[model samples]
Target: MTAVEFDAPAGLTGRGAGVPLSRWAAQWGMAVLRLLRSTLFVGIPVVLIATIITYGLGALTDTNPAAQVLGETATPADIDRMNHYFGLDRPLVVQYLSWLGHALTGDLGRSYYTTLPVTDSISQALPVNLSITLLAVLIAVLLGGALGIGAALSGGGWFDRGVTLLCSAASTVPPFVIGIGLIVLFSVTVPILPSGGYVPFSEDPGRWLRFAILPAIALAVEGAVAIARQLRTSLVGELRENYVTGADVRGLTKLRVVFGHALRNAAGPAITVLGYSIPQIIGAMVVAEAVFNLPGLGKLSLDAAGKGDIPVIQGVLVTMIGLVVVSNLLVNAALLRLTPHARRQQP
Candidate 1:
């Protein structure tokens, strides 16, 4: 064969030369569209059902919102007027529809106690939760990834045994329990980090970090342990696969074969675990926030529920559900991108 013919076949086999840019772009676009469609398919019904239940529970409660709003001295006529103003005198369905419509427009109604808009309350509290949650996730991923990778690479050695034991111990403890211990050690005994409270990052980054670190670590321990265990299992399985042996036989360095190839293949399940961890982290935040006294949504929801502050409660529930849905969507998108099998299964 001529040189041109020989080189042309090689060029045809090269990924960059074989696939047109337009084809690559089209594939990514299709993947994104599929992701969005699936998200909507699952998210809409979940939100609808959850909102309905929330509204129903509030309506069923014996605590009269008007009674809560007006003092004991308020007359019957005054209570009736307040109920009328709140549209509580209307049918449950009508009241729900009105609330839903307003919620869609970013008005979650005024708090029965404070008379402040629900959105305003959420806006004030959201940053604290976000700061803690994001920080916890970052710590979990970093610590878990390191431990898992190291354990897997150790091939059932002492390091692997130690990691397995540590993860098992860590998983058994609740975040709040961990938070209290952290307080005792870091806040009380050491007297270094603040025991409880939050400061906005915009005010002072140093103080914010100090306030956030302990709570973040408290929340992180469980997540890190979960991720570590999941990743270790997945990585071990991946390392035993034929492709790993083939890569090793191809004279690739052990590190590259393990990290570059095996890790990528093993990461999907770990990512899924990480995604599911968010809701659990949020749930744990209630106790963690209480222990730490951070003014996050969990604390807000708890206080609202205690006082039968329906609007605030509803807003918090809806916001949490939205967070979960968005996190799942992002996780699914990441899975589709990282795992060929996930994309191939997509219709």
Candidate 2:
């Protein structure tokens, strides 16, 4: 008898193989393209519809843009002249098309109140809102994840009961109410942090953090409670699955079985909870920003709406819609990375 030997293919033999690298590259490229296509498919129609509604709102209202710009003392002739200058005399379809074109090109028009470009106001205010929101989200994720994991590991003990009770109580309280309480406790009682007012990070990072902490905490409370509840439930369920038993039987350490296996499996619903919380956080910012005296987009929109500053209002709303869309895109990308099922189902 003759013994025969065969060599394995290069791709099967090593991580350095060209075929595997090319296959990985192709998969990543396809995933990115699909993500982009999905974003555009959803974003374009949403923006178009939102813009149409926002533009039509001005026409529906009794308030005239010209009157808003020119003030109460302006004569009818003056208002008419101003309207013509703004091309408001044109057909609705024409006006909308023109505005859409300019918006697409990054021109949101001048504010009727300030006579400054709407983009300028949004640009100045967007950072403050983003800072507060991002900080709040970070705080929520970290604190919530910790509490949830701890409670799950506690196995229906005192810690789990306490966390559940805390979440229930916290969920009932509004962000503004929490903001006021934080102000009393941290700002007034201890006198360590400022009660209100935003400092730009560029001007002073320390002061910016000082001013941001309270409002961020207030905004974080609701999200934290929500995440805690969701994650605890998911983790508890995951820990009971047959796979966990298999891991234990394989002699995997308790910590490894819980975190490395169970946590990852349980994270999908928690991620979804986090993603849905973002828009709620944005909405809550109106009260949070007002409470904190932060000159953010919420305040900008509120002030603009009260004064009938249509252009500014439109700009702020559209900017918010864009933010929501972007956040959802990020969430989708994160899911693709974390969830095997999502990756398998990807187009």
Best by lDDT: 1
Question: Per-prediction TM-score, please?
Answer: 0.91, 0.88
lDDT of 2: 0.84
User: After TM-score superposition, what is the CA distance of residue 71 in candidate 2 from its true location, in Å?
Assistant: 3.6
Report the error of model 1 at residue 271, Å: 0.5
Runs of candidate 1 with Cα error greater than 4 angstroms are 1-23
For residues 22-115, what per-residue lDDT tens digits would candidate 2 score against the true structure?
Answer: 6665665677678778988998899889888988887898888788778889999999998887788898889889878899899998887678
TM-score of 1: 0.91
Q: Which parts of model 2 are misplaced by more than 4 Å? A: 1-34
lDDT of each: 0.85, 0.84
Task: Kindly report which residue pairs in candidate 1 clash with one another.
Answer: none
> Across residues 75-122, which tens digit of lDDT does each residue of candidate 1 receive?
999999999988889999998899999988989999888889999999
